[model samples]
Target: MENLERTLSTWIVRYRWWFLILMPLLILVLAKGLDLRFNGDYRVFFKKDNPQLQAFNRLEDTYTQTKNVIFLLVPEEGHVFRRETLVTVERLTELAWQIPYSLRVDSLSNFQHTEAEGDNIIIRNLVQDAPGLSDAQIARIRDIALAEPLLVGKSIPKDGAATIVNVTVQLPGIDETGEVTEVATAARALADEIRAHSHLSVHLSGMVMMNASFSEAALGDMDFLIRVSAGAMLVVLVFFLGSFGAFGTLLVIAMSALAGMGVGGYLGLPFTPPSASAPLIIMTMAIADSVHILATFYQELDSGAGAKCRREAMQESLRINLQPLFLTTLTTIIGFLSLNFSDVPPFGDLGNFVSVGVAISFLLSITFLPALMILLPARLPRFQFEIHMMTHLGNWVVRHRRRLLWSTASLMVLLTAFVPRNELNDVYVHYLDESFAFRQDTDLLDKYLGGLYYIDYSLDSGKTDGIHDPVFLHKIEVFANWLRQQPEVNHVNIITDTFKRLNRIMHENDPNQYRLPERRDLAAQYLLLYEMSLPYGLDLNNLINVNKSATRVTVGIQVLSTREVLALEERIHQWLSDHEPALVTEGSSPAIMFSHIGEQNIRSMLGAMTLALVLISLLLIGALQSLRIGLASMLPNLIPAGMAFGIWGILVGEVGLALSVVTSMTLGIVVDDTVHFLSKYLRARREQGMPSESAVRHAFSHVGMALVITSVVLISGFAILSLSAFYPNSGMGLMTAMILTLALLADFLFLPPLLMKIDKH
Candidate 1:
């Protein structure tokens, strides 16, 4: 193995100039990233065949599409009844209908209010006259709005301080982001105009804003996060590799990121927000290969080998580090490949992108890096202090083997116990933090208007026109009333509410008659009257289908985590089973889909991570050619992630969809340091027949500084993830960085002591 590596390095040195120029030109050819696309829609997280997505689509097909652009208007007086507020709302309401791809617009000024007028049914806008409305008229409008089922808590809050202009848009098949941007751009301009002209604070939010947030955060990461990560990495490299080595390392990482992203573009996979972390992740991994090679080369040169020893140093460095690098890269690729097992496509994309980056990094590390080192002489002296400190660390591990082994093992076990504390809870709206306008605006809406979270329930009556049956309406009314009573549920919109209103209107506007009609015929006639009075696009089609067999109900709730949502869903099922057995159909929506996936992803990742564990273990065992040493290596490789989750359970206390995949993601990466450390120790023991203490010393003497430097570089790279605006990327990054740091500790403080105790060197 050493002879082959020596030959390759010597050959690379012979043609160093040609290879260096050629490799970079090849990298440059692959560095064009403008062709890469990005998708920000929340739906991109789910696959086409995902049951929750299909159910949501079916629900959309039955009712109007729920994707909307909402403009929340907050009046200073804490009441939406004022004439000036109504005027602003009226103006916005009129403009909302004209938004590109808008299918319907609902607001307080355009609510199809119903009342009785001496044997005549009156249906008209609640606040059409705006400033011209008399005080008595405005008072009546407020009263009716507060009492209205569809308007209250949807357009006008039941508490009456804020109102929303809800515009439902049906976008074209292609360029969905373009359509969302158009609506958002127009809405923002319009809101700014309204705010400046009327002195009212208008906040824009909704499905569109959330979708746009994904794209905005991803683009921001690509534009800024990658650069920040590179700058941080250059600092780390300089601290470890010094100026000349750091420059070459940074250039290789830049090429790797560009080439990896370019490969993604070639594969036709767009970078969603979650996947946008790939460039930063790739940059970090790219440094690992370069650091080990260059650091070792510098050591060989500084050990009195001198300028003439460049080829020999490169040869020895490559010969020693090749197996570990290859193994680490392979495991990382496998770990990332496990992302394909995820329910979310973005994670899959992320896994593929980073996997490719890791692969390219390995190739460059072996070829381009060594060639660059030979071509560009790093005239700086070797960093002898790091080597001396690592020798002391090795000696200390042997001296305190018993205490180090027992203490670290016990502490890790204690940390692992906290892993169960984190629950699977995802809130899609909070996926982007306050660093984004969407989050700030969403928080404002949730605080003031009590909007956002929703669940769509499709209730089937089992027979044609059965929706008009008094029994069905009564059951729906009971269910809606039950939901409204729950603290989490703010509003429930049922066709039955409209039916009850129309029935009351038909019966001389008597409050006593504001209940489900006694007969099916009466309920059917009231619906007929209401449907006849509705205008185009504001018709009952959104609520009831043409067959009148099934009705769509929308339940509005506060922003709750998936754990809370799952609990609520279970309660719903229990209530439906006890009260109305046939109404036990499943609910669907973007919120529901994400809520369900947070649980499902954990289950799916369990299998994939286990598979990865087995496969990687086999690879390690085979690579080292020893059952005992390879099996022993598992403790160091696996303990860090387990310990990290336990600590995360303490620090963060809760995780979302990211928890399921973090194990595998960090497994491949964290194992690299262990492989580098262990492979060197095993090589020393098996080949040289060194005593346990000498073998441990030899291992540290070979790769200790590389292990620490690369881990620091990797840690810095992933630590950048903690700064992400997107929650999943942030969580994954923080978790990975924590595990990588812990892996360094485990490898440094724990593994060596265990080796000494086991081998009795």
Candidate 2:
């Protein structure tokens, strides 16, 4: 190992210029190749065989196959049963169907009105096909809507102030961004038209609209985050180093980021919201590694040694720093790789992409950074002010080590105990900040109409012919009733009860026929009659299945916190178990599936992170060849994460899907500080034969300034990310910054004090 180190030292001194030119060119070529080949889709989060996804696909295939967008309309004053309201509803309905890529459109005006005939129920379009309805005719339609049972208090608000017009769109494929954009634009345009022509106000809310809004927000935020983080880091580097040499270091870090991102792009990996931040993250991490090496390199050259001095400096720095740098990179990779356990596709992609990026940064820092240093002048630029500040801070740490240790420990324990454990959720509409236009529009719709988030339960009886049986119908009715009683459930739609009332009304208002049908055949006959009388666009697919074995009951839910969603789901599950024993295998809506997957992701990510930490800890022990030193090294790395989480729990109350991954990430970042501190202390003891306390002071005096500066750079880079509008990215940035800062303190104060206490043994 000594001979190899000496050989590498000689090469760095002799052929530095060759490495500097070749290394950067090679990186640029690789980056360009990857950039030309990159793909950018977000659906890669779900596994191909995910059961929930498969069930959703099945429903999508069998039922009305179209992507849907909902238009929620409201009046500022009075009920919607007026002639003016009915006319406006009809006009919007007509324009909505004319929208490009729209397969079908349904609103209060176009709803199928059903009534029982002799022995069956007859259904017909509420609005007849005509160029325009007279004012009197429109008034008559309004009166009928006010009197109708289902249309009265359900489709339209009970106050009659608001109503919804849902437009179902059929596109060629999910990736057809053009079609999605067109539909969203048309929907907004129609809303504008209604506002201009009439006094009525319209708000658009649905999956497609939300998706488009999210995509736009994500892209904009990505640009802002990158520019802000890079710009801030550059300013800091310039302020500290005060030379063109800082720019060269910055170039090396930038090259590392480009290489990492280009590799991902070359592999055809599309950048999702999380993955988009990988380049910035790679740059931040690389800066820390490069800054440390450069600081030591400059310090050695300032001592006024010759070629031998420069050669020895590079060797000593590399020998002392290499293991710690490698360990930090490995831990970071492990933490990021843990994200693969997340059910969310974006998170999984982020983990893989970042892990690869960190590896690239490590390699470039070792090879490219040294080459650049050798190519630069021996007497490089200096930061006299920063050097003075670091010296004073180092002196303070040595004096007050005991007090700092106690204070840190107490704060960590207090925060950990008080931290909240509220569940994390993904309410699609709520993901956007309040300042966004989409959020404002969605909020308005929810206040006037109902919320967009819903839980669709398809109750399959496992027998096609028995769908309309009295037992099954009664079970569904009871389940719907139970759901309505829950606070989370805003609306419930059960076709059986809807038609059963219509059948009773047609039987000369007889009380005997008011209840559910006794036989399966009678129920089937009633449904068949209703289906035949329905309009062209208004189909029975929303309420009934094609096989007739299962019935779909949709329960619209109000937006709530993640805890509320989980509690609501649990309550519904328990209610079903108690009331409907035979109603087996209930498939939930897309919204509910998102919440489930988020919760699962948190658990999986935590498990993976814990495993990674354990593996990293084991690796460190093997590398040190001393279990005592290895175990001692863990306190600086591990405690910071616990402290960060504890602080997060106290301050934030609830940690989400993003925060769950932070623990693993903190493990990797903190390890950098530990490795640097411990490696220095060990060398002072075993190689130079110093006592433990002398060794602690020697190690701190030598590497302490560089460690402080590197932490500052890392913290500054991550802190800029807190400005991001995206919740997950911001959370990660804040937590990572906090953890890195705490790790630096721990290494400077706690590690030395603890080591002092241990050496007494």
Encode model 2's per-residue lDDT on 1-761: one tens digit a residue.
44665566566556767777788887887688454322222234456666667777777776665367777777778877655676788888888988878878878888776555566566666766433667677667666676554564346766667888888888777555566677788888888899898777777777777766766666777688778877888887776654555776688778878888777777766676666677778878887777767777666666554445555676666666676777778877887777777777677677776777788777777777787666566455564565666556656765776787688667667756654543365555766677676787788767754567676677887887567778888888878777778877667777776557655756765768776777777677767766677767777787777778877777777776666766787788778777775674545666666666667777777788779778878878886667877888788787787777777766666676677777776677778777777777777888898877777777776677778777887898778876666667777889899988888877877888777667643
Off by over 4 Å in 1: 15-18, 32-34
Clashing pairs in 1: none
Name the runs in model 2 displaced over 4 angstroms: 33-45, 82-84, 115-124, 127-154, 174-179, 305-320, 376-379, 383-385, 420-426, 508-522
> Candidate 2 lDDT (Cα, whole model)?
0.71
Output the lDDT of residue 485, model 1.
91
Residue-by-residue lDDT tens digits, candidate 1, 499-601: 8788888888889988889998888877777788888778887888779999998888889988888888889989999989989988787878999887778
Listed in order, each prediction's TM-score against the native is 0.97, 0.91
lDDT agreement with native, every candidate: 0.85, 0.71
Instruction: Locate the minimum summed-lDDT window of 10 residues in model 2.
Output: 36-45
